[model samples]
Target chain A: MVMSWIWTGIVLLSILCAAATGKGGQLSSAAMQGAQAGVTLAVSMAGAICLWSGVGKLMAVCGITGALSRRMRPLLVRLFPSAAADVSLAGDLSANICANLLGLGNAATPMGIRAAKRMVRGDIATDELCRLVVLNTASIQLIPTNVAAVRSAFGCTAPFDILPAVWITSALSAGLGVMAAYLLGKVRRG
Target chain B: MTDYIVPILLFLAAAMALRRKENAYDVMLQGASEGLKLLVSILPALILLLTAVYMLRASGAMELLSQGLRPLFALLGIPPETAMLVLVRPLSGSAALAVGADLMAQYGVDSQVGRTAAVMLGSTETTFYTISVYFGAAGIRKTRYAIPAALFADLVGFCMASLTTRLFFPE
Candidate 1:
């Protein structure tokens, strides 16, 4: 709640400053348009994500996800050693991570939730949950559909300009995240 | 109407295909039933983040923030205009990309600034928006290091983008 209040204050401060400096009024029309545009974009994104989740679910029901999971299990197990063998929460987490990297957050979020729920059902330790959280946060994405979608939403012809940069940064961040998670796993009070 | 035809047709076809399959419907229902709480939790955070961004852009604070950071920009081979681009991109991704393209077209993509802008475009995440939304959705009460960590990652991204461009696209 404190953070929420602080955030609110910052918004008010930015608005007030913009208005006084005349930039606020200058861009009043554009800002209004932007708000409309932002809403449209957000809604579209939400819809797109929902669609993807549906497709993913279809894939799962058809045994596609399981098939893919089986193929990926070896590599996935290495990535998430603590996860139970075959048909485990860690495997689901890896699928979610994969989806997130592809910029399917909507789809990935569900998978992630499922994974977390499964982990909880398995009575996974808090430490593993935290590690999964870190991994999710640090999940290295390649396509960055959300970012690219945002770029396209704004009308850029070349959304992939940021691809290389995203790749490098995410890879490093994920590497660091995994290391940190591993270290924390070793030392956490839990 | 014609311009929208392709997307419309694609969706219709996909829907038709899905309708023929029973499994698709079940999977959709199962996943949709969850994550609603997380989505609800973060709505306020988004509203607040947007308000803050609006305020910063309004008060001329970002301009000041930009001006103060010019020297650092120059050191990284970043064009002055990119300050505005980076500042705006997170709030509105398309606007930032447009700015980057304009800079490239104006200065030639081979120019240091143009390339830097390109790299910048790819490298950084929408910091404030992302932090607000993700943290909000997850009900993450404490973001002890997420902000700093993300920004630090952005900084690293900025540096790497420039470095890689120079190495690969060397003049």
Candidate 2:
């Protein structure tokens, strides 16, 4: 992919620069530090996500997911007509998405995958699946918790300057994503 | 310094409270395990980034970039060193952090470069990192236009931060 090529080029260039500068030794030293920091960051984020996911699991067990599902059923039914009105997958998707907005991508991903699997495990038609894909792709996360957390870790004083821009970007991206998915579905149908 | 501590502690407390009847510690450990896996996956990239940063610092490529960008920085009323941070910040935040620290050490933290570096650090996202992780996770194989779009947003942030900081604290 083009992204792969760009990443490769950047890596090669950095390596070349490193070798040419005769600072290889120093680089290794700094690399250790960098790796350590990355570990800490990954742990913190993953921990937060897991904690939330655990709570979500509890809510589901307590029938909260079902209660919420009843309320969200109308909207979800409209979103995926191919899906059965009584399925738990719709509720799961909704709940997963709710967690994702709160900045829990790790938790959201598994929940989404489970929901998607449930929705499609039966003999659903291909067109409906495509629609579900579009909806999932267009799932707009209003507050980017991961981005905000990273900014805070980096010593950003306000940490919310890009809130306006990110929200706009997310909305536009979601809209385009949905449109693209719909077009892909339509093309296949045609 | 003290101000930052409160928010982090509050966050930790809230994360703990989310446990309710369940064991918060166990959940956090599960999260940590997942985080550790992510860390391991990206360890190679981090190593490369750190090395690249060290080489850049020692060989003075950062200085060269700063020199090249000095005029532009002047027009924007920012220090030349700030430009290097702008480019580096997105590529590798750790390296950028090291550079920022070095700059702060060289010049007082209250200096123009120091303040701009701080603002730049605060305002911008790690563009390459975010793009790589998000798009990669989503299985987005092509970023023909996305890279430019993200970087363009980063440019806007950098310019805005510099201008805003300068306007408020004209030095």
Candidate 3:
């Protein structure tokens, strides 16, 4: 529901801005370019995401994913009680979090999608599913690899010096995001 | 070490499957197929969102909005120059990266604004991108409060990045 509006907002705002700036001629080209980029992105993602999903599946069958999720069970139970009630749903959630923690972003999305798919109980999203999305959005990073790379590329002497700041800010965001989702979700569900 | 993580994980999974006497090849294929199906559900959302994000970027709207929001962002201690990072970080990943990289380029990576931009990128998630992909895959059309809550957290995360950077790297 909100997504529809947000999507509209961006497109409409972009057109309005373009017109106001007299860049109206650029809007069509921009929209088409974006569409083309999305197609390319999806095509590239298909290969990597599927391979990771395959590997992820093998891990699931071998019980490694199950073990990983088991480790995250206590925490997940409190955050996603409804989804946690199911084995595979919790498993995918656990796997997704673990991958994100390691900064294995390519490996995380497939599990995230799998878990999210299972979270669908009806047309509307449940509180637990919303929490899952919230958690992913605020996932704490054990290694800010991409940021470090960018810093080093720019010749920052102590690239990793930002590690401490990253950890604190990410932890704060993740905690606050979870809390916000919980409180807000309760109000809505009630 | 970081580069070897994926291969090592694959090795462990394969080893375990062999020991368990399971057909690893078939299992992998099954997983791949399921994932492929899930991607079908996610691709449309990705395309639409990306289109909007790219359109917004190309039209210079994001920059304009970011510029307009600089004053408000400054009130929260965020550097006025990297105001665009806080604005676009939630909407698009690559765009945020460009903003962060641009900040580092323009103001030396070791500078205050540069450090804050890097930390902000590392700490916060791409909210709209994640929500759309996750919810779209799940076939959940009506995301009641998730967007508001996540965006709120993002706002705080951006402020905290500025705050923590100042606290840790005081001049």
DockQ of each: 0.26, 0.13, 0.77
Worst 10 residues of 1 chain B by lDDT: B33-42
The candidate, 1 or 3, that scores higher on TM-score is 3
- The whole-model C-alpha lDDT of candidate 1 against the native structure comes to 0.58
Clashing pairs in 2: none
Q: Model 2: runs farther than 4 Å from truth? A: A11-190, B1-60, B75-77
Top-lDDT candidate index: 3
Give one digit per residue, the lDDT tens place, for model 3 in A56-167.
9898889998888888899988887865569988888889999888887768988987778787888798888888888888858788889999999998778889988998
* Docking quality (DockQ) of candidate 3: 0.77
lDDT of 2 by residue, B1-171 (tens): 434542553354445445445555555455445544544444454444444444456544566667788888778655666777776877765667766666655664555666566556644545566544443333444333445444545555566656665665578
Better of 2 and 3 by DockQ: 3
Candidate 3 wrongly placed segments (more than 4 Å)? none
Clashing residue pair totals per candidate (backbone < 3 A) = 9, 0, 0
Weakest 10 consecutive residues of candidate 2 chain B by summed lDDT: B135-144
TM-score of each: 0.68, 0.53, 0.95
Among all candidates shown, the one with the greatest DockQ: 3
Model 2 gets an lDDT of 0.54
